[model samples]
Target chain A: MDLAVEVENLTKRFGDFVAVNEVSFSVAEGEVFGFLGPNGSGKSTTIRILCGLLSPSSGHARVAGLDVWRDAERIRQRIGYMPQFFSLYDDLTVAENIEFYAGLYQVPPALALARQSELAEVLELGPVLDRLARTLSTGWRQRLALATSILHRPPLLFLDEPTSGVDPLTRRLFWEVIGDLAHEGITVFVTTHVMDEAEHCTRLAMMHYGRLIAEGTPEEMRTEHVQTMVEVQAHPIWPVLQALEKAPEVVEVALFGDAVHAELRCDLNDAEARVERKLQTAGVAYERVVAVTPSMEDVFVSLARRWERPTAAGADR
Target chain B: MGEPAVSAQGLTKCFGAVCACQGIDLTVAPGEIVGLVGPDGAGKTTAFRMLCGILPPDHGTARVAGYDVVTQSEAVKARIGYLPQRFSLHRDLTIDENIQYVAELYTVPRDEWQSRREELLEMTYLAPFRRRLAGRLSGGMRQKLALVCALVHRPEVLFLDEPTTGVDPVSRRDFWKLLHDLPRQGVTMVISTPYMDEAARCNRLAFMYAGQVLATDTPDNLRRQLPGELMQVRCRPQREAREALKRCSAVRSVEVFGDRLHVLFHGTADPMLCERLLADAGVECLEQQPVEPSLEDVFMSLVSEHGLTATATGNGL
Candidate 1:
């Protein structure tokens, strides 16, 4: 498979603090690869390394099949990066901002203009082209930034939390644009904490404490990590949660919306009966308790909990 | 709801020609967590400011903790804890000192400071890091400190604006747990978030779009508004399956979810219809099942029904 991004034992350190600790992953061509982690999980660091903005302390990385360290400048031309913070010139109009990035990327004048018009149409930025970038809403600004990033038509794009604060509608629309780009053979490497957005990616790598904890398709992650998930809808959920916390068969429990999602070590039937007996003994009334598919969020929570227990016990030792 | 802890009637706000919020009505029963959810420029922040007495509504009235927000702004402010998008904790100060400063700003009684400080720290799991500089804490830890500072006075109501947007999953979960614990103590909270999952966690949700409240209901009730049964289809060559399904007369909408496609039927379309369509198109259908509509599906349907463009508009600018 032609890889758009490849990392081998990648690590970054600032003095004693390890940011990206031996992280390794690869993205196939035309793939929508999602890098998911909590804040301070070294996602930004890894992206920066791939973008040639930062150097890794050890290991090797390649973007667009060029060595990140040796071909840093070449990699810059082959990849487009959209940082978490909007980096466009706020004082410039939308058209001017796109033109500026186009010039910086050294696109021919005629080609730049043509690509600008194409992007404006695809991103629906035509109406806002003459408006100052500063006056645009977060959603519009993000769309403009996205347009600017892709003006050079790089084969690979790195978007760091591009839809972080936008509304659901804008997010969906943005993903649609991304999907279109991927269909056109542009590899998209995006980072996000939102599980739903992560689910949109063709593959996902979940980071925690500067390490890649899990990586796979969302369905695979859920099935492999979580055996049986029981969703309990009950009034006054707190008491039920406390009761289930002590149950030996319950591996992990977390709130999912108004319901309590409990991952059980036992099969669905045994777990349901055990949970029912406990809820009844505790005098808690439930609307429903049924086995359900674990969402990506549930899988992450379960993995994080399991990861923490051993470390927490080690701390006691 | 008996004598809502927070109530607004025809509350409106405009920024020059932009109507950030228009005739918005809201109510939150005591001890309930109501989420104000929408996209950027949906006026969630503007509505929050009006209710918290930071920005006066241009029209109508709002009351927080029995005090009119416009007429008795100070009283309203005193009874509520407001955590804006930017909370402005003294980054140079230690977590302990930041709490002390906020307590002083809120004029918390000197006699109650020590115990209240300890309690808030313990509640947020910041007790061990009390001596750490606020700037040095991780994104989640910093938010926890901010939460602790916000609760220094133990206000009856809390207004949090996108409090967990960029935090990691573990931290986000921890933060939600903190918020979940508050309702039991008779603290009413109105939190604004762009996340559907977080919105689902609320006791009630107000879906805002284009400065208007589209709907307000519990998660289950809101989901019931989705017009038809959602069928989860696992098929090979997803793009082909999606296109084939879209051409089918019975399909209302086809959404891509990872490797699978969620097809919403118009009315009660038979599952066999989809199977037949895919088979005719030569797309392999591995599995199919009727599934529940997620909050995202419900929100997407609602937004599209309202003729709101998921794409950005320059009208506000």
Candidate 2:
């Protein structure tokens, strides 16, 4: 299989702080690779290393088969990056922005114009093509930003939470466009806060405190990390939650909709019995307690428990 | 149950020629959470502003905290807490000072707010950061401090407008746990979020689009309302299966979920039919099973039925 991105023992530091610490991962050509981590977890730093925007303090990376140590300039040309917040020209019309990016990316004139029409059609920006971007809503701007980033038809894309604040419908469309690009063999390296969107990635790697903690397909990660989770539905959920919190077998308890999703440290039957006993002791009326497939949210939340929280006295940074 | 914590009927608001929100009917029972779910220009903020008594509705009746939002807006305002999207925590102020300022703004007696402030700070894990200047805090900490300030008055109803849009997964999880604990303390909440997970957390959701509420129901009811059974099929080289599945007449829609396809059938979903199709298409299917429809699945279907376009006219209504 052809590799699109490769990293080995990558590390970056700012004085005493290690931003990306000895991380390693690889993405296959045409794969939708998701990078998952909490804030300050070195996700952006790793992306910068791979995109060749920032030199790694140590170790190595290759983007589009070019070395980051020696071929950053060429790597930049092979990748398109859309950030968490896009800074599109407010004064530029949707079409104007596309045309400008076309020139900036040095796409051939005719090919640029052709891709412009194609992207406009794909993103469904035809009606508002002439409207100034400032007047466009968030969804429109996001689409325009995506269009601009890929105007050069780069084989690889780096999208940082592309659907962060987008409405569900527009967000769905964004993923569809991404899927289409991946199908056409454009490798996508992306980060997202929304868990469902992470499911769109062909494979994923999770980061915590500058270290790669886990890597696999969504299903693999779900089962391996957080075993069968049980969602308990009880009236006056507070008491039930309190009861479950004290239960011995309940590893983690979170509210999933109106239900209390309890991660267990034991077999399903033992855990369920323990949960029932506690709820009964608390006199909470429960609708049901059933084992559930742990969502990516559950897995991530379980994994995100590395909160060696900084106190006022300790927070001298 | 004698009176709803909040209720609205035929809520309409317009800005110039743009009808931001129209003919909306929604109610929040005491101790219940109702979320306004929509994309940009979906008029969630318009309706929210009207409900909060900050913006008057063009044509509507809304009673918040048992007081008319228009005729008795002052009374309503006194009984509610609002955390807008761009909540400003004074950078110069320490976390404690900011909370004190907000308390004074609401004119809560010093004695009344001190305990609540302490409790709020403790719950959000912000107590340790009390002496830290807001400027020195991370984005997540600032957001938590803002929430603590909002809750300083201990209002009966709370309004949070997309409180965690860009907050990281861990912070978001922490923030949501805070939200879940509110109803237990007798505080009803009304929030707006573009995220499906947040939407699911609500007791009821109003899915808004193009300035209208497409559906208002509990997440469970909403999920169950989908007409046909759903199946998740995992296959290698998933794109081929997706294209072939799209051609299958029995399949209503084939949504790509990583390397799996969520096949929503036109009628009763047949797993054998999918396997046969994949077998004929020369695509290898590893696993196939009927699965519960996710909130996104139900929502995407709603958006499709509503005919809301992707561009969605990003007009800031």
Candidate 3:
């Protein structure tokens, strides 16, 4: 596979804290690769290091065929980055912000204007082009930020939680634009806390406590880590979960909405048999029962819990 | 429980000539969780502000626990706990200090303050981190602390504006679990969220867009009302399948979802059209089946029905 980004035991230290501890990964060209983790899990640190905005204390990273540290300028030219925090000039008009970034990237004045128009159409910013960036809605600001980042037509993109504060509809829109860019052979790397957003990625890496704990497609991660995932919607889920806790096969039980999802270490057939029998004996009104496949959330939680075991230390941290 | 804890009739607000809220009519019954769903700038925050008595509406009326929001603002404020999008906790204050401050602000008796603070700290898992500065905590921890602060006064009604926008998945789960428990203690909550999955947890939800309620019901009910049927089609070379579906006359919307494509078609569309189209396109590994629409699907359908394209529309958080 053609490589878009390559990292070798990347490490970053800030005083006593090792922000990113010896992580390694490579993305195939045009792939949407995700860095998944909770807040303060070192995802931002890794992305910053890869973007050449921060120097890694050890190891190396290459972006778009340029060394991240040694050829920072060349890497910057080939990559577009949107940091976690909103980075646009709040005081500038939407059009003015795009033009400022275009000028900074040295896009030709005439070409920049054309690109701006195209981006406005794609992001629905045409009507708000004259409005101050601060006056625009949060979703509009996000789109404008994304439009400015891609104005230079960089071959690689780095977005750190770009959809953080946007509504689901706008977040979906933003992902579509990102997918369009990836379809054009531009490699995309993003970090997010939203699990469903990660489902759209081609490949993903789950990180925790400054280490990469799991990496694969969502399907692969789910199958490998979760044995039996079941969702049961019933009245008084707490009592059901409490009884299930005493069962031998049950490993994890959590409340999801009005439903209680229970994880077991055995296959679905056996787990279902036990659950059905128990609930029937208790005369419960079971709305539904199924041996459901694990959602990205279930997999993430399993991975995090697995990593807490001392015996699994080598594979996790 | 039949009578609403909060009610608004044709509520409207404006900042200068721009309408922030446009005649919103809503009600939140006691012991109920009403999800105030909307894109950013859809006037959710403004409506929430008016209902909570924080901001005076330009027209119409709102009441909290039978107290007028305009004239009896003190009564409205006393009965409700409002958590704004930007939490107003002092950065320099510790978790304990913030909770204490909130209790004082609400005029809780000195005898009851300590126990309430302790219970809140324990419930939010902040007891261990009580001495930590508010600004020093991680995003999830800070959000939890904010929630704890909101609950320390034990107000009868809770209004949370985009409380979980930036929280990690695990914490988001934990937060919602806490919300589910609040009603048992005689507390009513009105929360706004951009996450569709989280919307599933609400007892009832209002789908808002451009300052109007598109749908209001349980998540399952809203999903059943989708105008078109949705199917998840998975196949190798998804591009080929997408192209085939687009060419088929039966298809209405075809959006790429990770490795698969979510194909939407009208009820009158030919059922076997996908198979015939795929066969003609020489697509392999094609798998298709009818599936229930997710909350995201319902959200998209509502937005699209309103002439908003995910590719060319803004959704504020």
Candidate 4:
């Protein structure tokens, strides 16, 4: 299979602090790959390496079939990156920013105009094309940034939380462009704090404290990391929460939208039944205790919790 | 429930030609957490400013903490705390010093704030790092310190503007635990958030779009109000299937949720209709199942019917 990004034993260190530590991952062409973790988890370091912005202290990485170390300049030109904010020149008009990127990427004058109009139509930037970038609101600003970055039609796109502060409708519209771009064979490497947005990725990998702790299809990650996740409906939630927290069979439990989600121990064959038995003995009547499909956030949280146990003593220090 | 901590009617604000808030109506009973949710430029922040006594509304009236927002702005401000998004406290100051500065600005007595500061720090688990510089703390810790400062005055009502927009999932959940505790202390909260999952955490929600509220209800009631049942359609090469599903007359709206297409139908979900549509388009269907509509789903469909789904021309968050 063709690959868009390949990394092996990649590591980066800033003096005594190791940011990206022995990480390995691969992204197939046209896949929407999700890289998620907390802010200081070093996902950013790995992304910088993959984008050819930072050299690894050890190991290797290749982008668009070019070695990141030897072909860093070429790799930089081959990928599109939508940064955290309005990275465009604030004084430049929407159209001017697009033009600047077109020239910077050295797109042929003839092809640039066609690609500009194509992306304009896709991202709905035509009406605001004349407006200065600084004057645009959150939704329009994000769209313009995304449009300008991909003007060269690179093979890979790196979107850093594209819809972080955007509304639902605008986020949907933004993802529509991302969804279509993936189908057009442009690999998308995205990082987002929004769990549902993470759900759309073709595959997801989680980083924590400079290590890749979990990687798989969302479904696989959910089942493998989150054991016997269930949503329980009960009255007077506070006492019920306290009751479940003390139960040995339950690993973690928290309130979730008028209900409580509990993760039960996997060693026991009947995890759900164990929760039911515990609740019954505690005289905590529940309306239902149905197993739930753990969300991407749940999987990530569960992974983070499990990763924390082994290093709880000295990792943070 | 006692008198509402916040009440508004026909509140409106405009910045030149742009109508930041058309007419917003909302209420928050004492001890309840009410969320003003919408897309960026939907006026969540504008509405928030008006209620917090920072910006005067162009029309209508609002009462915050039992004080008229227009005539008694100062009194209203005194009774409430507003935590703006990315709140930048003096980064050079220690956590305790930052809290002291805010307390001084609010004119909180030293003796009053001394005990309050200790309580807030203890509640948020920031007591151990009270001497840490704001710049040295991590993102999550910084937010908690900000919260401690916001609560230093012991206000009756709190206004939080997108508090967890960029926080990682695990930390976000931890922050929610802190928020959930505030209500028990009789601190009513009005928060604006772009995240759908976070909306579910509120006691009530007002869905906003284009400077107007579309609907307000509990998350459960909001889901039940979706025009039709939700169908999760999984298919290989999702772009074609997504387009095919969108084109189908029976589907009210189609949203890409990770690897699956969440199809909201006009009435009952027609499985065979969807199958035929994908087949005619040469797309392979992996699985089709009935799934519950999330807060995002409900909000998207709520706005799609307004025909504002593709329009990025809204006011401001």
Candidate 5:
């Protein structure tokens, strides 16, 4: 595969804090690559390093075949970045915000005008062009932020939690635009807390305490983390969770809304049957009991729990 | 029975001629967990501000625990705990200091401040780090500290505006657990989130769009509103499957989700449609499954319905 982003022993630190520790990963061209982790797990630090905004404490990274550190200025011109919170001038109109970013890219005046018009249409910002950024809704602000980032038509894009506070529909809409960008061969790298969003990425890497713990496609990660999961919705969730916590077949147990999820190493079909039988014997009236599909949440929970496992005896991944 | 914990009637807010909230009516009962969900600029924050008495509505009326928001703003402030989208805690203060400051602001009894402080810190797992400077804390820790401050006074009603937006999935889960535990203590909560899955945790939910409430119900009810069959289409050569499905006349929307495509159709549209399209496209598949609608599905359906109208008004879908 053609590499769009390449990292080798990438390390970053803030004083004694090892923000990113000898992490390395490669993203293919035209792929949606996700960086997944808990807050402060070095996701942002790594992103900043890739975006040429922050220098690594050690090691090397390349974006689109250019060394990130040695060719920082050149690499920056070909990559678009949208931070966790965009720095848009609240007083400026939507059109002005786009114009400012375009000017920063040093586009010719006539071409800039055409680019601005094209972006306005693509992002639905035409009507709101005259409105101040502060007056736009949170979702619109996000759209405007995305529009500004891609205004330069960079070959690569970096978005950190771009859908953080936008509604699901808006998030979906945002992903659609991202899909379009990727289709046009723009390599996209994004960090997000939403697991469902992970499902949209072509490939993903999960970090924990500054280390890349797992890296794979979403489905692959799910398969590696969850052998099987039995889902049950019952009146008494606490008791159900407690009962499953000690089950030999159960690897992890979590509460999903009102439902109790039991992750098992046993076969899914057999585990669901056994779980139902056990609940029945315990006199639990469950609204539903079925084999649960692996989700991004299940994968992360399993990964987090692995560290908490007592006596790493007889453990198999 | 006498009055709902929070109630709004024809509540609207406008900036000059621009309408932010357009006659939105909502009610939250005592101990109820009501989720206010919408994309950005959906006026979720504006509605939250008006209900908390921080921003006066341009028209209509709102009451919190029978206290009129307009006339009894102070009383409303006294009885509610508000955590805005931005953390308002002083960065210079230590975790304990921040909690103490909020306690003092609420006029929490001097003698009880220490105990309340300890309890809040313990519940949020911040006891060991209580003396840490708020500025030095991690993103998740800072969010937790902000939440601890919000709960230190034990207000009868709590308003959290997109409290878990940028935090990682694990922290998001922990924060929501705190929300669930509060209602048991007789504290009603109104939380705004852009996530659809978060809606599942609430006793009731309101989907907002363009300053309007699109639907209000439990997650289960909202999911039932999806108007057709859904299929999770997985196969080898994923891109080929997506391309083929998009051209099929029966498919409504073919969303590429990681290695699979979420293919939605108006109705049954033939179960063999996926296989036929894939075979014709020469795509080899691992598997495909017909699945139930997820919260995101419901969110997408509503947004698509609204987008048709929103686009009609110059926004373009």
Candidate 6:
């Protein structure tokens, strides 16, 4: 199998602080790989290192079959990158921005014009092609940025929270382009805090602080990290959660909207009985209690909670 | 649930030729959390700004905490805490100093400063980081500091605009937990967010699109408006299966959820029809089962019903 990205113990440090600590992962050619983490979790740092904008403090990574450090220049030419912030010239018109980027990447002028039209159609930027970048809305600007980034038709792309503050409609539209790119064999390595977007990737690596806590297909991660969840629909969910916190059969309890999802240590039937008895004893009225599949958010919260508890305990020791 | 903490009728705002918000009507009962949810450019911010008295509406009237937003703008401002989309605090100041500064701005009594400061810090788990410069705090900690500053005056109503957009999942969860605590203290919250999952946490939600309110209901009730049964299908060569399923008359839509496709069909449609379609397309079916609709599903259905295609336009792959 061909690999688009290969990393081994990739680490980055800023003086005494470790931004990314010995992380390892790989992305196959044509795969949509998602790197998910909260802000300041070293996700950006990792992406920077891979994009050849920042060198790793230690370890190695190969992007598009070229070493990120040793062959940094070559790798840069082989990959497209869209940063978290708008990096294009705001003073330029949409067409001018696309042309400028195409020239910078050394696309022949004739081919550049053709590519420009192609991208405008694909990104639905035809109506705004002559609009000043500064005057465009966030959605249109993002589409323009994406079009410019891929103007050279690189084999891999790095989208750093491309939809962070974008409207849902625009986000879906952007993902449509991303999906199309992946179909045409362009590897996509995207980072986002939005769990739903992660569901679009072929596989995911979840980062917290500077460490990777989980990595797998969403289903695998759900099964491995969050084995079972019992959803309890009850009014005053906070109090019910408080009561369940001390229950021996409950592993963890979290607020799921108006309901509570409790991870149970016992079998489903026994756990249901235990929960019923406990809630009854506390006089906490519940509308329903049933076992349910864990959502991606549930898995994330459970893993984060579990991860934090051990670290806190170790700190105490 | 006495009088509404906030009520707005026909609230409208226009920027040049673009209508940012149009005839929006909203009400929030005292002590309730109401989420204004929509895609970007959906007028969530415009409506929020109007109700918060930051921007005067182009037409209509609004009252926040029994104070007319237009005629009694000062009173409305005095009774509410507003956190904008961006972090808007003095980054050079320490967390404690920022809180102190906001307290001073709100004219918080000198006698109440120390205890209120300590209480907010403790509640947000930022007590230990009080002396840390806001600039140096993590994204999560900075948000917590921002929240503390917003709550410094103990306002009756709170307006948070996309407060968790870029924060990590752990911090986002932590922030929601803090917001969940406010209603019990009689502080009503009007939060605008682009995230559907966060919308689920609100006591009520208003789904907005193209500067108009599409639907307003509890998350559960909105989900029930899907008008069909959702079938989750796990199949190989998913792109092909999805395309094939879309051609079936029984299927209303097919949404990609991670590696699977969620096919929404009329309740009277036969599930076996989907299997036959996939088989004809030579896609191997791994698992198929009925599943409940999530808030996202509801949002997608509503948006599609309003004329936007529910699925993003792309080559099936």
Separate DockQ for every predicted complex: 0.53, 0.52, 0.47, 0.56, 0.39, 0.40
lDDT of 6 by residue, B147-266 (tens): 889888989999999998877666777788788889988799999887777888898999988778999988878988888899999998877898999998888888876667889996
How much lDDT does each candidate structure score? 0.85, 0.84, 0.81, 0.84, 0.81, 0.83
Name the lDDT value of residue B183 in candidate 3: 87
> For residues B52-142, what per-residue lDDT tens digits would candidate 4 score against the true structure?
9999999999999999999999999999999998798899999899999999999999999999998998888787778888888888888
What does the interface RMSD come to for each candidate?
3.9, 2.9, 4.8, 2.9, 6.4, 7.3
Q: List the residue pairs that clash in candidate 5.
A: A137-B41, A138-B41, A139-B40, A167-B39, B235-B285
Q: Return the TM-scores of chain A for each candidate in numbered order.
A: 0.93, 0.94, 0.91, 0.90, 0.91, 0.90
For candidate 4, write residues A1-317 as lDDT tens digits.
79999999999999999998899999999999988888788887787887888889999898999998999889989999887864788899998999898999999988989998998888878877887888877778888889888998899999887887776766877777887888788999999888778777879999998998888887787777776788888754555676897988777777776677888776435766777888899998888887888777777777787777353331121
lDDT of 3 by residue, A105-138 (tens): 9999999999999999878787778777876667
Off by over 4 Å in 5: A235-252, A264-285, A305-317, B234-269, B272-289, B308-317
10 residues in a row with least lDDT, candidate 1 chain A: A308-317
Q: Compute each candidate's TM-score over C-alphas.
A: 0.93, 0.92, 0.93, 0.94, 0.88, 0.92
Q: Could you give candidate 2's per-residue lDDT for residues A1-317 as a string of tens digits? A: 89998899999998999999999889999999999987778898898888888999999898899999999999998899998788898898899989988888899899999999999898888878898888887777888999999999899999988887677766878888888899899999999878878888889999877999889998898888886588898765666777787777777787776678888888866766777777877788898888888989888878766333344331221
Model 3's alpha-carbon lDDT is: 0.81
Candidate closer to the true structure by DockQ (higher is better), 1 or 2: 1
Ranking by TM-score: 4, 1, 3, 2, 6, 5
Q: Candidate 6: where are CA atoms >4 Å away?
A: A246-251, A264-269, A309-317, B248-250, B309-317
Q: Which segments of model 4 are wrong by more than 4 Å?
A: A235-239, A246-249, A266-269, A276-286, A309-317, B309-311
Model 2 agreement with the true structure over B66-146: per-residue lDDT tens digits? 999999999988999899888998999998899999899999999988888888878887777789899988767888888
Error of 1 at A25 (Å): 2.9
TM-score of chain A of 1: 0.93
- Write one digit per residue (lDDT tens) for candidate 5, span B160-211: 9989887776667666666666877888999988776677778889988777
Best by DockQ: 4
* Global fold similarity of model 6 (TM-score): 0.92
lDDT, residue A79, model 4: 95
